[model samples]
Target: MNANDNIKIDDLKKPYFVWFEENWVHDDVLHHHQKGQLVYVESGFQYITIDEKIYLLPQNHAVWIPPNAVHKTNSHSEKIKLMIMFADIRTKNSFYHKINVFSVPPVLKEMIKYAEKWSKQMTPDHDENLFLKALFNELPRFVEHSLTLHISLPKDQRLTKVIEHLHHHYRDEIKMDDLSDTALLSFRTLERIFKKETGLTLSKYQQMLRIIKSLELLSAGHLTISETAYEVGYKSVQAYTRSFLSVMQFRPTDFIKTIQ
Candidate 1:
């Protein structure tokens, strides 16, 4: 799909499903749809911003976006394969109104591939409607494997500056005093407001950012564990490994093996 192309939500007929294998580098403008969307990432990663909360969808995971939720997407990966399934608002199940990330089951993955092929070979009709209904039935199963990593942005301009700085300089050693100065807040105030807004202390939030970025690097398979460690602000490979294991529940090598 063209980066400039915006899918028209109003033009979509009820009980319709369409799929796209996006292989582009673009930052989508903020938009919302009347139909809920299921986005499966076959390879690489995509960052989605919904209602000011950033959710990172890594490979082999899918995100279910509720209808009428404003969101935007940005991808830096050279190869991005995404299959998007649209569900009518009326047919949206209990997953509506919340964004969910889950491990895509093998059955549902095959169903998405089959639906993509079926939609191309046949026009809309009763059989397609039946297929759409079957697809909707399978959606609720995804919630069982939901991954919750709520990375929300602060509304305050001062905190926003700090967050932006962290993203850009996550590779370097970030000090609380420095961040406090950047936000024009004292250390105590910064800690209080950051935890209040994001439910994570400044240090924990920065660690989360490093782990998130490490996933992208490790999944890409271009960097060694030691390189990735220092690249993401960790002083030692062991520390990075422990942090990765604590957050991702797996070793870096194990994660690399899975992607391979």
Candidate 2:
């Protein structure tokens, strides 16, 4: 489950103070942004809608949303996050793509927080601008999914059956015995294989899948919070929000607005 995607910004050109807020039980409509955005999830979970594609990103990861892409967003719970909006696209850029999530070094985090704070200060000092420029120029080119979970299941063809089942039935409650029967493997073996291939336990992976699908539905503006939660196999909207916050660290509403 996720929160709404509605971002309210102060000014892109001016420096600003952004607070991470929390809200549960929300569903957002399809929307896009007019400026480039840099987002970091500090505490909870969030889903980003990119051109109708859903990306499930958890804590300590970031996603770049470009201008003019209609999308929706949700969260399992309210989360803490940082959002930086840019007005111009510089020629000297590192990553060619928009969305990115990787393990951030301590220096980078400090730099981002500092820049954001300094920007909001809005001093007329050339030294400050120069320092900001240097920081941006020196920002590292990081690989995405550097620490992301990657799980690979058993090679048994029957495992394919299990995967197929999950792909279609993520909306429904999942039981180990049911999954085991479908995969034609013992529960014990399937458990091991599931972790081996996916890098997440069965329930954990299911949550990830739900997060992935939530972004899709959010981008399409097709469902309500209650609907989204139930559709994504969540038993309660509050439960969904809690999960979302664990991944995105912000309420779905704020996330949607920022993306929008």
TM-score top scorer: 1
For 165-255, candidate 2 gives per-residue lDDT tens digits of: 7768877887867788877788988888887765667777777677667654553445776787777888898998887666556555544
lDDT by residue (146-223, candidate 1, tens digit) is 667657888877698889988898777777788888888899999899888888888888888998888788767688
Candidate 1 segments whose C-alpha is farther than 4 A from its true place: 1-6, 25-27, 91-93, 118-123, 224-226, 249-260
Global CA lDDT computed for model 1: 0.77
For every candidate, C-alpha RMSD to the true structure in Å: 2.6, 12.0
- Model 2, stretches more than 4 Å misplaced? 1-27, 85-87, 92-97, 116-128, 144-168, 171-260
lDDT of 1 at 249: 73
- How far off is residue 30 in model 1, in Å? 0.9
